[model samples]
Target: MYEHLEYYGVSKKVIEAMNKIDRKLFVPPEYQDSAYVDTPLPIGYGQTISAPHMVGLMCEYLELREGNKVLEVGTGSGYNAAVMSLLVGPTGKIYTVEVVKPLYDRAKKIIQQLGLENVEVFLSDGKFGLEEFAPYDKITVTCYAKEIPPALIEQLSDGGILLIPVGDEYVQILKRIRKHGTKIAEESLGHVRFVPMV
Candidate 1:
């Protein structure tokens, strides 16, 4: 996994998380052998685990800290959240939401199976931004959104970074938005494809 991390240009934090967390545990049992292959595999429900390279790129972009409170949209198989949990450690909290019920339930169980005390799962729309736990230090929306929802921007803490893939269905741009007081700055990281935000 560390070899894959290096191939993906992962940061120290991401390397540590991917190394410590068993990718096989997050994948469906039948697909366990392919977990650490640096590729995304189907996990039913029309979802595929985000490629390890992609996860590494995004985590390196987030620059997570030990006690940061993070919110992850589009939990999918909970693999990304698991990586986030590892980075945030026991003192931090990671709240993730998946729109589909089956996927949400699957993620919840996988997270529990992993015994991640700092992670929580929700069955909700990622667009709504889980405002109940407002002011997240960082937010990563794995799905594609047309624009950064007002709810998400409002929920971000001052100086927080929000990353999302934004665009129309077929073509999208990976965007990084940083909050600065009442002002927000945006830059395109690059082009990418992500499932639409539900």
Candidate 2:
């Protein structure tokens, strides 16, 4: 899987972080055989764990550094958050939110089982962007939104980066938003398909 990711131009650091977390562990037993195939697999609740390449791409774009706090909007199967946790290291923290209770409980349990101390899973509407831990250095929204949620932007620290998918339910454009003082810059990373942000 690491070699596959490398072939797609995934950065060495992101691949290394992905290697530390077993994708199979984050997937359901029925999908275990397909875990390393680099495709999104359903994890119940009509949600899917993102494809490995997409996860790599997002991490590479986010430019995560050790000790940098991150906010992940969609917890899904917790695979993405797990990858980010390693990139951020022990000193850094990952605050992830999921609106679905079952996903929230399952992901929280798996994260705990893996002993990822820097990750915190919350059961809440991610659209709101967990204001209690505002000013995240980096923010990633795995689910697609009709538009970039204002709460997320307000919570991003100055000079912070945010990655989100915006458009209709069928397809959306992945946008990279940067916050510089009161100015916000947006760039398109290309089109992507993801579950709608509810």
Give the alpha-carbon lDDT of every model. Answer: 0.88, 0.94
| Residue 176 lDDT (model 2) | 98
Off by over 4 Å in 1: none
lDDT of 1 by residue, 1-198 (tens): 466577657877788887877778778888888888878888887777887889889998887889999999999999999989989888999999899999999889989988998999999988988989989999999988898898888999999999999999878999998999999999999998787777
Instruction: Work out how many backbone clashes candidate 1 has.
Output: 0
Summed backbone clashes in each candidate are: 0, 0
Which predicted model would earn the best TM-score?
Answer: 2
Model 1 Cα displacement at 15 (Å)? 1.1
In candidate 2, stretches whose alpha carbon ends up further than 4 angstroms from where it belongs are none
The alpha-carbon deviation from the true structure for residue 122 of candidate 2, after best TM-score superposition, in angstroms, is 0.3
